[model samples]
Target: MHWSTLVDAVVVAHQPHSADPARYDIVLGAGVRSEESLFDLPAAPRFELFAGTTVAAASAGRCSAVDGLFKPRADPAPVPMELIGCEPAEPLLAALRRPRRSERNWVHLLVLDRHGAEMASRTVGLAITGARPSVLGGTLIDITLTDGGDERPSLAARPIWAQWYQGPPAEPNLWAPYDTQGRAAWLDLTTRAWRVPAPRPDRSGGEHHLDGRFVTDVPGLHCAIAEALLGPGRYFGREWNAFKDCLCGGFGVAPPFTLTWHDAEIARRALADVVEDQEDGLSYFEDIVRLLERYGVTVVLR
Candidate 1:
């Protein structure tokens, strides 16, 4: 479970608000597992609920326990990182020297397997306000990620999750063993997975079987569907809208085929309480089947 082979480099780029982002001059080479800090999230703080009591203490009715309004996520701290053997360009140097909040930069870290094929693309806000020469003959830059925007704490995941990024397991049902928290982290990384593998020449139509044994939650369903359509460690969609985009062709497979969902009762019960659309009143599982049907895919829920 060597991690050095898990990542190739952090490709930095400037993203304009109006235009698409392109590659910038700086590329931060990956260091050993110990030197990498991009995924090193800080420990989450513990929250304490306060109990309130009145001085009178004679009322049998009115109980007052104030609701805690603690902030879910604080701004992540700056992580010190060293890029090996890369010289900064004038624009990057200028931005570092005179940092501006309005300008946007992104650090896209490409995860690779032992064979050098890309497995995922992890991104963070690149706020490099200072830099200095490093002993490794490279530039040491300060990296501070912006807010997660989804209220999740921008923290590091367990090493096991990182180890899993080496590649998808050789067998199917790769994501079935993880607990709820572990599955959430796995789904997070799955959403970041970019299709860098050589695309299949025929991404048009195919019959795919979905193993619904692990579709315990919405994210798990996404993970399962991606593996079903594409392959393990692949990404088909994140939410319903993105799933729609995938079904519209060019995302590994087109519609007009059959999908036999084996062990479908698992997902049906798991997602029975969840709803993707209120108007239809269909559960998440049913909505997914309905969406697939709309796209001309015959779904046989076994």
Candidate 2:
């Protein structure tokens, strides 16, 4: 039987790559169900097991369980382009031309809690406009200064040649003066600021800097934000810890100063209080939901 039709949901309790053992808990409704272990599923790359039920009564529950296992898949759509005249045309053009790598661009992903047991996830990418590398692209530049105070013309011997010959046969005073080169020299040409066109209005949002002070009430949002700030590899480590930590209070490490963390006890007391105490009236988890809606983050609810 096709697992998708019978299974209402699949919850991956653990992943193989994880430091912890991988396990999945199959939840079935009050009806008969069957399962098949698959080496591969084209649409779900990570899944190793397939489950479902023919009983209609339990279908919804099974679907929910399956949906919970993986993060919602994203739509890879091309971004729309808009043309706007540059205000400070010279600097703006210069900034764009500066050598930079796009892959280094930073992004944030957050996972949040839904109901008591449910979770959600999202990702957000950030870019700093109008910034460029200080040095000319791939060019190595160096500088040297000669002291004119000496009455006699200074004869300088190259250091590399001197080293290869064991020592300079002549006086030490004849050695050439050294100079700074490449990236070192590039660091010296410093400026406070440059002008670039404002980021697209649609891309910009209310300026709320996320700091440690805010408490989170949603685990999914917390996970998503953690993924966003720390990147995928680190996020996975933090995520496993966060889930276990929620069951208990201490994360062993100090609370994350970067993204939000939900206090499960606080969430149990009152969600409103959890929301209000949150910075900007949104925990890192809730922010994930909002961000996903605007930024093409896929959220699949089981």
Candidate 3:
């Protein structure tokens, strides 16, 4: 079926490179109604280590700093889904009859908006584990879905996902005053907004002014920087390491540009409350300004 046929479909199975590029619908409503698992991501594993005797000292009421490590990506858990009133095409039915570990069984599960636009998508290896009769008068299929790619948004960030599902906003700084988690979610959404990499940095060395009134925290700083560099609700990076990667290329605006920051004093005091990376020995604002200078950006502070 054509892609447009699946508009407003609760769940869709898409095959992009197939001869017909079919998008099959996985209808909702009936016996299965709980959808909390669809929005949750798996917990990440973190390892923490302390110096010898540090643990003992901590037990004795002495404080000691510990080193922590985490992977960039987490191993995702399988999504248990129950589909009611699903009518599969012949090809999809044949594949589901004897599900195996094959490319044909791997499909993108798209979550659609009320208007039938894609809100979010995930690749999953689908297998029909069992089938039963729905009490409401239909077939109920139990499907076990293993993660093929893309982590789901965290619960803290689901509000942003819900907002974007309606479509992109028309204004800037909508994320202002939201705690760091919300602002971080805003940046994450920006990363997925475009299919291709961001355009090359502007070589004309144009002047981009930043409104620093809302730069109160680390993630807020990132949000302000994104809008300053790429316009409203755009993304440059979400963290310091990612920021550096954006500077090298692909995130719009190279060095030799001028950035005039307005209301800089607000961030100077507000960012002081944000404590991170004590080993860096510099405030968040200072570090950002220094990095910009190092990369050939002419920063004018007001």
Best candidate, lDDT-wise? 3
Report how far off residue 229 is in candidate 3 (Å).
1.2
Q: After superposition, how far is residue 204 of candidate 2 from its true place, in Å?
A: 44
Which candidate number has the best TM-score?
3
Q: By the lDDT metric, which is better: model 1 or model 3? A: 3
User: Candidate 2 on 1-302: residue-level lDDT in tens?
Assistant: 24433333434343443343443344433222324534343563432332211121221222212543333445444332111222335433443454243223332222112222112212322222333233443332221111111121122212323232332122221111232221111111111001122322121222212222222334323323433333211121222233333223221122222232323333333334333222255533443344444433333321
Model 1 C-alpha RMSD vs. true structure (Å) is 18.2
Error of 1 at 41 (Å): 38
Record all residue pairs in model 1 with backbone atoms less than 3 Å apart, i.e. clashing: 41-156
TM-score of 1: 0.55
lDDT of 3: 0.62
Candidate 2 stretches greater than 4 Å from native: 1-75, 80-95, 107-244, 251-302
Query: If both were scored by TM-score, which would come out higher, candidate 1 or candidate 2?
Result: 1
* TM-score for all models, in order of appearance: 0.55, 0.17, 0.60
Report each candidate's C-alpha RMSD, comma-separated, in the order given: 18.2, 26.8, 18.0
lDDT of candidate 3 over 1-302, digit per residue (tens): 10001122242232343333452222222222222323322254232322111112111111122111111335456555555555545655676666674434666666555566555576665666654454446444333443434455567777887877776555778888578888888887777664344356355488988889898888888888878877876778887778877887766667778888889888878876443345454666877888889988899998
- The models' CA-based lDDT, in order, is 0.60, 0.28, 0.62
Ranking the candidates on TM-score from highest down gives: 3, 1, 2
lDDT of 1 by residue, 1-302 (tens): 11122143453553333432432222334422323423432354332211111121222222121122222345556554434434577655666665665247655655566656564555654555345564555454433333222223233345435556566555667667776566666666666455555666546556788988888988788888888887776678876778888888776688878888999999999989876444456787887888899999989889
Number of residue pairs clashing in candidate 3, backbone atoms closer than 3 angstroms, sequence gap of 3 or more or interchain: 2
